[model samples]
Target: MLNVARTVRCIDDAACEEVQLFTEEDGEPERLGEYRSVSGLRIDKAKVRDARVFRLWGYHIPIIVDEEIKAALEANGIVGGKFEEV
Candidate 1:
């Protein structure tokens, strides 16, 4: 099993639309908007420099993996997960 070390947010330039942002209230912090679809997603490399695996902050559906980990998984013939470069 793979474990995520942290979560990172997409950069401002990410191409997405119709995102719904939830305002901070009742002691809860403001959350990033939810995207039905996103393209040109870019993350701050500095934030994930030490992380081999991580999920997108606030949108945990995409599992990001480093090149080394991707290679290892491919070499091992692991299946079920589809990979796309972000």
Candidate 2:
């Protein structure tokens, strides 16, 4: 199973005002997507949704954010924070 750390960091690859998420699959890092944001570090819900960041175990959207962010995302109809295999 692939696991991404909850910590978010900024990439310094000359891409300005955008955040990039690189997914590690099979020991290879692939560019998931690049999202444009005002601060470029604060990942918003839409970008998360677009990137499908919560998905794991073959398309299940897992809860990956903290309570406050989880609550806010849930309020907006995004399900996620704790995850388990069934």
Candidate 3:
């Protein structure tokens, strides 16, 4: 299961760009990606605007996804653990 924790740290696009995504490798945070996926391919603008920090499994996956992504994930058996605000 993947656990996601939403944060209000990203108040705007520029600020969101400053956020970093990391992987929980060896029980530690490892730099893996950035928050610029919002400008990537096949992404929903509305969803990117509402993006939040998702703790995917054990990695802090800071990326953007829409309801379709969520639905697909759930449909594939991934579930949210709990509601967390930060």
Candidate 4:
């Protein structure tokens, strides 16, 4: 099991993928392609998606963000919050 208590510490370095503007109750994540294959993605502090911060597993992720959400993410500490890319 992965101990999620540590933010930077993870079981494996995998690039984060874009889930969705809103998470589906079914616990499914939406996939977005990436430009580069990466172990993990650090959430952009500036682009806040919503109450929850979004993270991608790696660098060249192909997920698109909403205009408003992108702006908010950039302006906030979406990276340091209660969310991490798996």
Candidate 5:
């Protein structure tokens, strides 16, 4: 699960489509009830402006974001983890 600073209920696109999520590791995704079939396409911080972090289960994760998400993490203790991208 992503430990995003904001209390995210879900990840929705501009169209409000729920982004399909899957697991590359284990346990985490299942915990948050998120299942997406990802291609391991990781984005750099430079391109993470549109990204939003989510928690599959409970494993705190860092995700892409513009200003809002970034501020959220920094404001929350989760950012103290000093975690980068996966």
Candidate 6:
């Protein structure tokens, strides 16, 4: 278990061109098919430095977390959520 406290921060300098913008279909809001995959995700680490948790603009389905948070969750036996590197 991590003995140190973790502070979550939010930064707006992250950018990912690979993610497709969400769109509406049949009057229902939906994300483009491409957004379903996180392959080729490119985020500028310098922009989001020190941020332990954050969500990208226009895409909120997956809440991004840093290594510390990930470890904490795993150490506590968190379930029902998938963790993928950005």
TM-scores, one per candidate:
0.63, 0.22, 0.26, 0.21, 0.24, 0.55
Candidate 6 overall Cα lDDT vs. reference?
0.55
The C-alpha stretches of model 5 lying farther than 4 A from their native spots are 3-62, 80-86
Q: Given candidate 4, what's the lDDT at residue 43?
A: 43
Q: Any runs in candidate 1 off by more than 4 Å, and if so which?
A: 1-5, 10-20, 23-37
- Better candidate number, 1 or 5, judged by TM-score: 1
lDDT of each: 0.66, 0.37, 0.40, 0.36, 0.43, 0.55
Give the Cα error of residue 3 in candidate 6, in Å: 23
lDDT of 3 by residue, 1-86 (tens): 34555533332444332434444653444444433233322322444355543322222344434456656776888665332222
TM-score of 3: 0.26
Best by TM-score: 1
Please list all clashing residue pairs in model 2, or write none if there are none: 63-80, 63-81
lDDT of 5 by residue, 67-86 (tens): 56667768775634444343
Q: Arrange candidates by TM-score, descending.
A: 1, 6, 3, 5, 2, 4
- Between candidates 2 and 4, the lDDT winner: 2
lDDT, model 4: 0.36
Residue-wise C-alpha lDDT for candidate 2, range 14-83, written one tens digit per residue:
4335433435543433434433222322333433443333432222233344456556766887643353
- Candidate 5 global TM-score: 0.24
Candidate 6 on 1-86: residue-level lDDT in tens?
A: 22333332222223444444345653435534324434355556676767677765444455777899889999999887688666
Model 5: how far residue 80 lies from native, Å: 5.8
Better of 1 and 5 by lDDT: 1
